[model samples]
Target: MFLAQSFVFSLLAITGLALPSNEGVKHNNMARSTKYAPKEPPLTTPWTDKVGTKPWPEYPRPLLQRSDWKNLNGIWKYQNASDLNAVDSPPFGKDLAQEVLIPSCIESGLSGIQTDWGLYSWFSTSFDVSSEWKNDKVLLNFGAVDYEATVFVNGQKAGFHRGGYYRFALDVTEHVKFDQSNELLVFVHDPTDDGDYVIPIGKQTLRPSHIFYTPCSGIWQSVWLEAAPTNYITQLDLDANMDGQVNVTVHSSANGTSAQAKVTVHKDGKTVATHEGPTNKPFQFTVSSPKLWSPDSPNLYNVTVSLDKDEVESYIGFRTISRGVIDGVERPLLNGEFIFMFGTLDQGYWPDGLYTPPNHEAMVYDLKVLKDLGFNMVRKHIKVETDLFYRACDEIGLLVIQDMPSLRPLQSVLPDAKQQAEFARQLDVLVNQFKSYPSIAIWVIYNEGWGQITDTYPEFELTDRVRQLDPTRLVDSTTGWVDHGAGDFSDNHHYANPQCGTPFYSTASSPYDPSRIGFQGEFGGIGNNVSIEHLWNNQAAIDTINQTYEIDTTIEAWNYRSHLLLGELEDQIRLFACSGGVWTQTTDVEGEVNGLITYDRRVSRVDEKQWKADIQALYDAAAARSSNSTRDSL
Candidate 1:
């Protein structure tokens, strides 16, 4: 009965459904803690119950997926210790004091243990190896761990990784006890603003208030295991040219042995191209009558790669993205056609799940809602999300502008040598990890002046490095404040008063150097404190809700403010000639009520139809201006 009701509810959600008022549901004392037995569950999404048995059970890496893999995300024994030296000793035999949900962070509500225990936490679990994986190398893969993570297998150290935002794998072939249960343990340490190191920690604050959010710590993503042959396909690089051909590179490692690879591309369940190449070289093949990928039609071609005894399934889209001058005005072009890039600032935060969503459907829901609202692009602000997010964007045909997570303490000077090196290493890893996704069009190296504050502007060098690494995509050297004469776009930020709407948009100031494209990186932060009557009757939300909203005048003021905000948006896009613009945010984060949707994602403050119309008008106007077409014709 519940499943049937849930299905009905989803169907109703597509058009729009009025939410039940704040009543009936019981509110519990749900304070965040690190204790074994906390008061109660924190705020939960509608998909909470669906996170049963094996949460995030799907293959962690979608671009390179295999059927033979194990999900280790259900339950794991966890122990929190203040002593930093707890990682020296192996935790294979010790009994942990508590059990926490894997993949979700300790600070999140869905993790079972809603806590802020950021550093020196140990987690352990045991799993048996299948008979099919006996002769192959058993590989342990971690989707991501905050800050630093060290792993141990059966009382022996397997490997360690430094970054908190990228995936890393280790080959545990020799250490595994075949066919028997083997103990696995991992220790994580995150200095989330508590330490003196300069690491990239996008928007996380020790004392969170206003724009800063709760610091996520320790195992915030998925962990799993897979079996691969000694001679296997390690990585894939895909590039589709406008000339009806794609360059496919299959990276294989045979442990000093030779291997041959066969690549095949399929469209509409029919084979379109095939090539056989040496394991070390890339193969090029042509697709006859190739269908291009765009927002209107996100056509994807399935790829099958076979290397000796190993086989993997992947997908790619053929599209071209570039910046060009059309009618004397420069704009972002898609498939040799001028396009106006309008997008939202997505922080990738949730009330229940910090880094991870409640379920896969929830991730898709966010993108779907935005797409339905007539958005063609999204600027993933600061943090790097899981592979599922990029995949969802790809399938939904939403262009993505990925930001390199910024460092903490808000420095006005350049980072030290060691920290700079660390940032570069992580940046390289970030590009290599998600570069295969065709949805990702822009790589933002530094945001505002978070870490690169030197007069020499180190961001220029960083942007050059990124361009060299992934020349296929455009690079935005800095988003808001500084531009060191590098990258493809010159960006600016604006927040003008609603009372001065037309004047503000008409005469807005930005650094528009003729050599690069122009972009309004961020603008318009119109606050609308949600009415308590509209929220769920749960104490989980009591802390994040604004007490000032209790006043009736505040509600009226915000409603009028919403009208003014819309006027401001209309004027900005109608008046400005920038290539694109990114609004402040998509959903309301804690303490910031400026999002189009509420933090819970249950309520949209603005009228949905009007909002979509306004956004579409902006796109059409920009397209007309670039193509030198009259607005009436558009």
Candidate 2:
């Protein structure tokens, strides 16, 4: 949630990751007609292709919801023109260069307009708002529009937003015309590799590498409107303390309007406990035998918050995370017990959809896979996802170590005197938005010291800023060794890793030195693809099996190097009395053939039963260690 520049400079190369839209370019403007380069396969959808048809049609915002909203998602007229003034006319009913899908990045295959980049491109759509919406209120919401966006509602200007990764809403209720069809226009300018602080740029490149795929831009999420009373639920923050007491923090435009939270604890169809309270300024309640939420069991209680009059309804969870000394070593305790979190660094990328998932069902599919694979946690490395993803994590019981995407500073050395404060501001909004979810276990400050190079002691690794924003959650100052004596855990990332860092205590006795609990923040990348798993869709799928497509044929008869992949990974996942793990990734991206599943989400490369057994063994080992430590103390 914040930046720390505690340590001195370190020399390391960390390129070759996921790519956003706005691919390779001096300028992100591909107005000229250039032949489309080799692309992936077309997305296979149940729906028949037609005009005015785009996937992801639900009202995007679940928090501030409205029913009387028109979807501006269908087909819209467009031109690959550089400037906005070229076509003076509304640009409607005019011939278009090619139909591009909404909620998908322009660079993606789903969006017909595949260009290297578009610093200047316009998205226009028109819809009629019901008179009901006119009477109450209207808000135009873009689940997220990449880079920069400007809105024009019904010939009148509305608002604009930057930051391609986060979501935003504009109250166009006033600017929108009442009776007539409203015109909504968006102009986006996204520079991917051109790192900026306002938006933390991920592995977005004009040309994608190792883990990075193509960059996504211009509304990769859902967009809709909401109508609310003059006084409505502004925000809800769920705070679960170690006392087993849960506090609900509600913020609204109007006060004196009472609020109560109805909570129900559940496990295997048995109602454990239920509580309801006047959720006025952090109401507190306790769960009996509080079926603590964890990766293994993920026991969760349902919470429904209603206004004084039972007007608006919102849902949250009751869970707490804290760091405490267990036996002699310190470890992260969930709810009350210590459980080691181990999982992949989910990049949240799709083959055809790129930035956006084909649909919500597809989005859920990814999480469900993680569950099936016996993963209790996921480290969202260097990127953020829609709240819906977090919501699913809450309901499904996946612990998240969310990393705020880093804004690449001008210099890679110390903290930027100018950008430091700005990064802090963005970090504040990020923490406030996702703090309530029960699945989020830790807040990661930096990934391998991305922006600030802190290779030595007392590193100013942005942990100070992160702590100020969210001291509740344990902070990992820097993923790798930019140790500045800041973070709660000494995080590290090792690719194709054979060994893990020494235990926190061993840092002094051993060569590693004094450190907190060590985690395999990143490790375990073994290139093992399934036969015809479809890493990239291509003409080869239709044509004869040429020897050139050797990878697929090789994988068809692929015997997983189980001993090498897991024997080594198991050893790594157990190192330094490892408290948690953020495995490389869940699925394979463009070039990085190091995912458990392919991009299409079809095949499982590894043996499920065998993998689970290995993971379970790790847990058993930890349990045994905890027991041994207890015995030795006596």
Candidate 3:
């Protein structure tokens, strides 16, 4: 009886039609007739138009590559539920009234349906499995979905995932028909600062203000389908270090225990090393005279792991991030040498795409521009970016200090057991998922005490667990306030105060512990709303400048003040002997106008050549200080 029902459903779906339900709503399975046109945003990049019908066509997962895959990042039917309770059932065969671009959030202008807030939304699309993939298992992957998501393949529940910033996959091989069209339906519920449950929401808020911006409600990253053999590599954990030692562990989906993996390491198209090892076991290989990965020389070694019938390609870079005592002062070290991590606080938000960048080129442009400006590192502030962003960093040699998104404090129903457990689980998933990226040097567990429970939050315990999970990288327990001094760096955040001779000042009166490296986590928030045409909202910018900075000044005056603050910050860094500092931001977000670059990305507030030279001078001064201190100690 069940087989007959499924067969009838498949036949109806394949015919590009659906039966009318008892509710008198006619269901249409035909392709959407509505054309996609992104809503006119306040600002857009050159690559905005390049995000055609099929956006983010590039393979989403670079670390784990396969020749056979399909990008499901195109037009999809969508329906906004009136409330959370209205999303009780999946709209299996119902025709959605609206169309939206996949990957871009419903709130983003790039999604075409830029509604104010969508707490509950449904998205449906149809895809056909290739004939060649008939013998292989089909995996449906979502880069990320805000809050909670329930997926259905051909009206059958496939999987459910909760987390706004982590990737999730559902094996829909059995649920999908190989020769017929398969209907994919996703129900998303994201209560951004409106829910009773606590989830990691970062700086997203429905009510946008000075610091917090608009919420990314639903699917904000790429969705795709991948074909894999039954005995395929599910994951590859590569641990490559500066000592020329490489450990490869392959996690597989094989039911039998007899599968062995042949691993090959390549450098510059030449095979450097190979090792055959059993699946699910760690195996070792060595590369002699390894070219260490650094900001100046970002060398990556290509790797391929082949099982009996499944093979996957990946890449790894050899580097180590640690803290070392240099001339009796602790400092951040890359590959056993002190390297100043001059960086910017990069909140990954776009005017058009919100949490998602318009396209791959737009994403690369930000990192490339930072690199060209002589900045070696970036603090990915409060948001986990798509894998492509990290891949670009790896290739471009920009160090990343990845921050875990914080939960809303006053809004969320926190201090409960369930919310706390969810936070911990999501944190674990985040660490395990992004541990393979060599560009990620530090894992910031908490930021500014946003969601921390002062007395009972277990900050130290959480920090220890993150360290245990990935001992290769550093773990920062607290980035700003409520520091338990539990992690590698005693980090702090301070904005520029023009009243002081040194605009940048640390809140801590006493010196930081000599055991832990002192770090200026955030500073230099100098408002430069220079380009009037590129402003997201003119009045908002004016209000922000007035309320936050309390200054009514001209563009030239603000820019001059910015340069003066930066000069003072350089002196402060030298005086404090801190490891590194991050300027408040890279680009202006929604209302907050204090950015080095304009929100539109078309205008640079500072002269690029002069900024680069100034940044290089900071690096030179830091290097000179290290050398002089060592000489004096000798």
Candidate 4:
């Protein structure tokens, strides 16, 4: 059911997904409110009775996994006031006008409370801690809050957090009523894009169109509670090697003092391994030629941890990620071989959820869909995701290119003297937040030129900050057009075509100090839009066709259309066998309409054969010298 022009495009796309993306977009309205739009639907809906209660309550963090956390997710009282200084009264009193949904932002429809003015919104909830956790410390957990947030337990401010992307905790043992229902109130303010904070907001707009959507305002992540002993583990950065030995540096609340840690590994629900040691010593364990973790085979070993006086749980994968000379060019070596990170520029957005995913399943669906279609990594463009998203990637074996949400006004990239100092403060905060996540192998500083101005100087400053934060993982100083001549990777963003800017790939500073790795951070955005079933339909937006597409560029048709794109992508990918390319993205976002798959994930544009062939070729070329000899020979 493909029309002539679409068919022609299909043929061309089959030859390759070669349309370049580097062409600078006409600076226009799209960028203004892109992140403001509600994104895609969820695999599960809390609104519907078709399914029972959403099962996400099972402790969101499966890595530093916990079995005894309380999910404060469902219902809550929310109201948006003109400003923080509002009518004097607790929410749900006669003073408030309406009720809002929990977990969904006030700007979202599902939230049951969408506000016009970016005002001060308040959320209040109450729950009783289980009697079993009485002796244990009660900790309030917020997966994320938009910009600035102050948390109160029993009407008393326990603690406050500023960054909206990373999770934060408050020891509410003193504030919560153990025997009675304890009330929790959270106040959030997100000056999304408009406000001058260093959040990495990509394509968020006040009015959505093309590549821009709605901005995620207010509390966009999850809220919950957990029970921990006086001493609990904070972060666990796990690393492994092909020989089957794993290493971990457990960051706990108590530092400088000698500590003991008991690590247990699990499969399914049963414990298959265990490791106990002193924090002063490296916690080591050996598995016999274990199933290595990969995008396809996301094998994870559960870890139940017991710190000297604390008992916590987490997980680990016995896989090794390294960088060495492959065919004379330096690239990432996974399990001792080069595995080209064919990925997407995932500006995690939703038509319905904005920054907050409509459902937990929606959160994990993109990675599963992309992995199914053939992709190993996702450059989490700009915005940072919840712990669940990272948990999904870690468990499912999807590599992450985690970018710190950039600051706004698009001028923060070249921070002024005043802002430059603030930049360090913010960067330091960001690094301390997610540095421990193992899947985050690369830390991207600025994306394109949005916030960047003073070319390499700002970049080097930023790069130096990241290296100072965590020395293990690699750093991509900037993801797009600018090069800092610092960081761990010579990264670049080229649209419509694939290239690592080979000229900069080899010298001591060629790949940004020659000692670093070279990566195609962004490229391959040749878009052939299928009008039908699009999240943002041009016809619908202009108030036109609701009729069925005669051309039917539906998933089936588009998948058929993929043959051309895949072949082209394959050819481009093959050109740099040794050097790797991170494809434009895993899923479609807004109007910059080129994706191997659709935004909703219901449609796949790349034909399966062509997609696999191109991917296999890239994998073969890059991983020809890996432990998986078959992959190398392919």
Candidate 5:
């Protein structure tokens, strides 16, 4: 009934008519047509709010924010291609008859068009370019578009992007009409598990029965426009060294090769350091007394960069991450100190928005809960999130283990060159997109054996590529199952307990052996209870290895069961002597109730206070070991 009313309100607003009072009339799902209103199961989060004209109005890129940008994320005209071939043609004059919400996946309930099977989706909208931006170049940015996207601005092809995860931008200055309104049309094609392409699908299958959930297709992220000077700063990379030095690399674009970059670092709004260098070269700077970034003290310094006629603001946190021997155990070190990463596998799924969060506050709430439960890290499983999500992790002081979304067909033994190259290219793009975020401490190139199925895994090649791209952070070539002796650490996945003990603490047998630091990439998938009211599929089998309480639905019973499950994690961390341990999940995804929190974010299965205390005790023990290790070395 709630969904039906929302649809009615949407239709009235789209047709430029006011909604009537909601008094006695009741509207049912049977009356609404799927063409106008999709028939999806009604599920909502507490963060659900009336999406006004401009949804997600916050600056999409918080780290590099500007005041001159305009948000293009409100209602957009959309049309699903009746014929797949129609997508190849430009959608300049074609009429988009249906209305859809921007930035939300079409399969999600919040999108207002919940049909997910469409291979080609077209979006068109008119936006005005401010006259103040006449002297600048107009840049159109898409936070993300799934699978493949071809963009057209005012009847001209502007740009094309292949990967669905990372952010991309196109200079629309040549395609835009400065004084008049500009028409923007984007065509997105996503072959999600349909066998048309072998790409990273990441827990999305067409037949989402047990472990997998629904597929997110087309424009699942924000789209916006920014006006920048013709000569602008394109990218910035910052690496903090353990010796109190930071390497700053800046890339800039200009009409000629004479542009130089001037950078200034500010601490507490006071200038601390400054450097001027060529746009193509890196600039090194040092501080007298550096304040490192950690869960305890997340100190960040603001920076401003200027090149020719452009200037942008950015911030960085000084920290170093590596793997080393500590207390006779191989462990991950942060800021020259060994730290055990106790985290959860965050799938980044929502009950309402599927891929996109309902609002910025919704994203913040997830991080807050993780921190409240005494977690120091989050292994972002398989999926690459928006820049805002990474920013939230940085601000909230949560370390990240970013995983490359797995390409499907795990059992296959042969490697395809085209798929392999595409995967590598996308991995490079992912690193370039998120390298500026200090929260990301490790990168997982492949998950289990999904994409790395060959006898000799090619992850060594991918791992080498990632290192060449960004050598500051550590890399786990493959998370679990079938190690081909590459990357910085060895990973194991087990249920309830990790069996690969002690060997990882010793020296490597061969110099080429990459399995040194042991990490429990995935474990402890314990399901407590399934809330029938919030179940996406009640009949679906619970997707977990260990079921704590098969039939317990009461809060008391679920809490008791979850307490025991979380307690097991503390023992597993020490018993395995792991550098890091990521729990099965942070929240329950569809058809899977193994998360510590419920699917709707309404209930935590365990007592928060007790869970925090237990996790904190483990953290205390790990710190003590690190201190002892330092003393022994001295």
Candidate 6:
């Protein structure tokens, strides 16, 4: 029987649904330990104080949202595991001697237990199933768990998940008792860079120095509980464009023969479009004169999908990112117009939280500051951030060049079959997971030859797969490496200054592919320590700051170099007709002091007015050159 939405709670009470009982489940009677306290960091953000008992209380997944959910992101019992065999025996119903904060990595200062616990660790907490959710399926959702995680509920092994950068969930309805406290335990194993296996560790390393950073092990994202109907909406694939046509695909857990889907799109609280169809089927609908999304005007429409009794809310922006001939040269186009993608290499890291941000505001603040400084884009350098970070970009109208986290040690030899399969699986996940975000303009496959298979075949294959999976966005096969001559962008990297004539590729001469757009993947390190007091206390980082190409000890010298470098970059776009470029970094990270912003984000190393003006000149130069070309063609 179909129950009305308003009477769902009342009807569930009298439904007489069979609920799990804790008949044989043992209960822990020991008192909770109070040993957990956030370790003091060398640098702290304003949001540090706000991260009290509960951090990241907001819903983790903004793309697919539910109104009723439980945030399990607070204090949790933790203990170090002696060996890998610990997964066989979880300390069920037993009190752990130590505690740590949820979502933060064990190596982070915010996690309380900042000591690295090697390969294995265990986490335990308890949550209650609401009586209103009696007939619903209780989903234990994890935003992300580093490396691998084994989950248990009520002493029963629920499920296991691998891959540190992707989200996963387990249906715990069978093990959870309704209207009662239920024990939930998770065991995590992260080898990081020390393991023999070739995993996508990005920039994490056991020994933190230079570009590699401290490893963020264990659960580094939110843990939550969501109640859903037995037959629910699993996923939504939306393909929106500026021409007012939207292709919608709704995936449901139920059989499509009987299930029905209703989609409604709203603009400014008014219904703009609606469609009714069957589940797991692709359908098309159109909006009247859609407002396109871009860095200048970031417009989004709220969407609601209903599948029988289950409903979810999400939002989408209409935009098209592609390469087109502009001024007789190929250039990146946003909404069919040439726009210079002036950006920064954004390493999404925080001193207090490590892989995770101190809070959502702190994450948004970084992007917001970039936008304020006239940067329209950010290349998320080799790090897959939580959904909140991308959602912030979607709302703030900042373009994102998302890089696939690569394996370590810069592989020159071919990977084994097992390693290749794992890399492909993670790459697939990275592409499919973030494809719905309109702000993501490009997908960067490999960076600077790290973990590259040393052959063009595998690189071409991976790039082809990403293109097939998401044909809407452009793909960058390899950035700053042996330019496999694949994907849409012929990208390259240089330091301290802009290289206009030909990009410096590591393997061979820079291939001038007329089919691909030219992009400066990285340039302009231009280091300046704005404040020594706020600098990272690492002596190696302090001593090595002057070793870079352009290390300015004073503000005046830094600003002068900044203008000169930006002027050269402007010429790269105007004189050489380069499409876009990414500056070295958004903020200084640990031992790498080459950032426009300091490591702690407390001070800006550049002269703000000059920096903003210089960036604006790059766009103006591109516009002027494009205009001249168009006039000449006529």
Model 1: how far residue 616 lies from native, Å: 0.9
TM-score of each: 0.87, 0.79, 0.91, 0.79, 0.89, 0.92
lDDT value for candidate 2?
0.60
List runs of model 5 lying over 4 Å from the truth: 1-41, 255-258, 413-415, 500-515, 537-569, 572-576, 630-634
Per-residue lDDT of candidate 4, residues 54-139 (tens digit): 32454766567666777877656554544555424434222233344556666554554444234466666678987788788888
Best by TM-score: 6
Assess candidate 6 and give its lDDT. Answer: 0.81
State which candidate, 1 or 5, has the greater TM-score. 5
Q: What are the per-residue Cα lDDT tens digits for candidate 1 across 1-634?
A: 1244333433443446753422222222242222232112334456766676478877889888877898888878676755567688554576665667788777775665555546677787898888789899898999999979889999889999998899888999888887798989888888877757688888886677667778788888889889988787778877775556787778876635556788888998899998887776666878887889877788788889899889999988888778776555556777777677778899988777777887889888888888998888999999999998988888999999999998863755446888888898899889988888989989998887788765777787888788777877888888776566778886776663321112223223334665577677877666666666434333433455553222223545654654565555556545654677787678877766677677777877666766777777767766666654422110
| Sort by lDDT, top down from the best | 6, 3, 5, 1, 4, 2
Q: Write the per-residue lDDT of candidate 2 for residues 530-570, one digit (tens) a residue.
A: 34546453332213222111233343333244335446545
C-alpha lDDT of residue 327 in model 2: 65
For residues 318-399, write the lDDT of model 6, one tens digit per residue: 9987777866787777877777898999989888788999988889999999999999999999889999898899999899
Point to the candidate with the largest lDDT.
6
Candidate 5's residue-wise lDDT over 558-634, tens digit each? 56755665565556456656566788778888767777887888877767777778778768666666675532111
Model 3 TM-score relative to the real fold: 0.91
Off by over 4 Å in 6: 1-34, 255-258, 412-414, 500-511, 530-532, 540-547, 628-634
- The 10 consecutive residues of candidate 6 with the worst lDDT sum are 1-10
RMSD of each: 8.3, 9.6, 7.5, 10.5, 6.3, 9.8
- Where in model 2 is the C-alpha error above 4 Å? 1-54, 62-71, 77-98, 195-199, 241-244, 254-290, 306-310, 409-416, 453-461, 501-515, 529-533, 537-562, 568-575, 628-634
After the best TM-score superposition of candidate 4, give how far the Cα of residue 148 lies from its true spot, in angstroms. Answer: 0.8
Looking at model 3, which ten-residue stretch has the lowest summed lDDT?
Answer: 497-506
Off by over 4 Å in 3: 1-34, 255-258, 409-413, 497-511, 538-542, 550-556, 628-634
For candidate 5, the per-residue lDDT at 297 reads 81
